[model samples]
Target: MTLWRLEWLRLVRTRRLVAILGAYLFFGLTGPLTARYLDRILGGIGTEGVRVQLPAPTPADGIAQFTGNASQIGLLVVVLVAASALAFDARREMAVFLRTRVRGAAAVILPAYLVSAAAAVSALTLGTLAAWYETAVLLGGLPVARLLVGLACGALFLAFAVAVTALAAAITRGVAATAGAALAALLALAVADGLTGVPWLPTRLAGAMETLVRGEPATGLPAGAALTAALTAGALAAAVAVSDRREL
Candidate 1:
């Protein structure tokens, strides 16, 4: 509890918590609003009096936009922001301080991760609800239960991302390198998902948000979620082990 509280303070002092939450809220609002007005906005941009025939936007369209924003930009934000959690401390002689302590890597890593995850999940939840409200008012009402499932799946991906960033920061000294390593790993997962439709891979959850929103039982997601959880745990464990090996 002490360590977790300390990490939370760090997040607050660093202003990362505020920034992440603000960005998530902005993106969330943008998703449905854009979906609702995209045609009107685009039509005004095109040649004057040249009517553009666009398919009617629906709740699905708004949700799809939200999913895309969260998966792409939101995923990147999680990696970039969390990448510095450990990297910045590496140069501060924290390694020596931690080495003298009784707590192992999990003790240190979990708090940082949970703080970031909590902020991310909270923002995502708030944002998604805002989007849902907008879509319900502008486009149409969405299936609440299924939307929640999709949000849960998306949050898992984010949790994995925070773990990966921690692992990268543990291995690398530079922020850019840490971010690169984490993003590269995510890209590999995405590529694997696109190239091969494996049922057991966690990447399925990343892409499964839309499927869940569509009310389709993600046949692969159950196994994929289990896989993602294992991988996140593995990443945190590896980070602890690696950080322990670092010279103070």
Candidate 2:
């Protein structure tokens, strides 16, 4: 309880979250606005009499654009934040007091992963909500049930990112190494899923998110959800194990 509380308190007390949320919020607004006004935006900058004809933007188009930005750019932010989850540590002598006082290394890792996942999920949820509302006002509202499914797709990927980054942290030191490893692992998952056509990978969930947003059936949803749940638990266990083996 104390660890969870500490992790949550640290997350809320920092300025990093404000910046991350603001960045995602900007994307949520701009993605739809860009899709909605692409013609005008291009026409305004068109060379004299050079016409740029564009297709009529659909709900799917706007949602696709938003998800594209969130999955790639938004994903980067999640990795960076999650990578920093374990940036603090005391020197060997200085670490003794707190290190020995806790239940185990898992106590440190679980709270960090859980708290970071919560924060990332919340940011994505709010950002998606903003994008949804703006799409309705500026474009057209996606059907509510489908919209929720699409949102879950992105949130699920974020949870995986958080878990993967926590695992990276447990095994590595420093922000760059943790983030780099985490990104590498996620990319590997994507590539493997593509080659193997596995339905249970977190990358599948992310891909399914895009599919769902576009009014298509996410046939892989069930398997992806099951795998995500399993992988999250497994990744947390791995993190705890690695952290335990480390010299505090």
Candidate 3:
């Protein structure tokens, strides 16, 4: 069987695929519901004397809720899943077996990275559609063009994230360390993006959905998206190089 098939089978046997999809889908289905009923939900909380009021939910609010949740905890699930798949050295025997059979580092690594990336994007797409449908039903209709654009931007970020996880897996000793390192790297990037206010930072893609829904001009998104693609390619190559040098 091909390495791609093996990587897919690894995800399936480990149930990481289900975890990834289920977490995103949960956020997608619930985010709109939460937005639509937030006022009512909050009405019962806190105290009997206090009250809170919120504006009527909009399509942007629904999508924002979904993206916000999906980008945080949902992204965590993707990172953990990808790191688990790419940290082949966690299983020393299997790593040795695969490395000996493969022609090169790329042959051993590319399939796993691509498979993880494909799975991550698929889960994100599923969640995006779920959010769109629920928001349309409960809040309001959204423009398909804008949603598609946002989804494309989001997918590019997911690719970059998986690439980062791949490189982390090459450097770390085990799945847990790989996940922690990748998450730290991602968090650092997010913090840097927020502090610098750089229009071209890839972390801006995290808000692309909300921005598109809010009718904001996406002039900076193309640059961020392009940089994300370039970084993804660079990270993947770096992962292969790092893995090539490591002892199996």
For lDDT, the strongest prediction is 3
Q: Taking the tens digit of each residue's C-alpha lDDT, what string does model 3 give over 113-209?
A: 8888998899999999999999999999998899999999999998899899999998888999999999999999999988988877888998798
Cα lDDT of model 3 overall?
Answer: 0.90
- Per-residue lDDT tens digits for candidate 1, residues 97-170, read 65467466666677777888888788777778877888888889888878888888878878888888888988
The C-alpha stretches of model 2 lying farther than 4 A from their native spots are 45-49, 87-97, 193-200
The segments of candidate 3 whose C-alpha lies over 4 angstroms from its true place after superposition are none
Against the unseen true structure, what C-alpha lDDT does each candidate score?
A: 0.79, 0.77, 0.90
**Candidate whose TM-score is highest:** 3
User: How would the candidate models be sorted by TM-score, starting from the highest?
Assistant: 3, 1, 2
lDDT of 1 at 24: 71
On residues 155-238, what C-alpha lDDT tens digit does candidate 2 reach at each position?
877887888887888777778888899999998987898899866678876655457767786777877887887888888789
Q: For each candidate, C-alpha RMSD in Å?
A: 2.0, 2.3, 0.9
Q: What is the lDDT of residue 3 in candidate 1?
A: 72
Number of the candidate with higher TM-score, 1 or 3: 3
Please give the range of 10 consecutive residues that has the lowest summed lDDT in model 1. 86-95
Error of 1 at 245 (Å): 1.4
Task: Kindly indicate the candidate among 2 and 3 with the higher TM-score.
Answer: 3
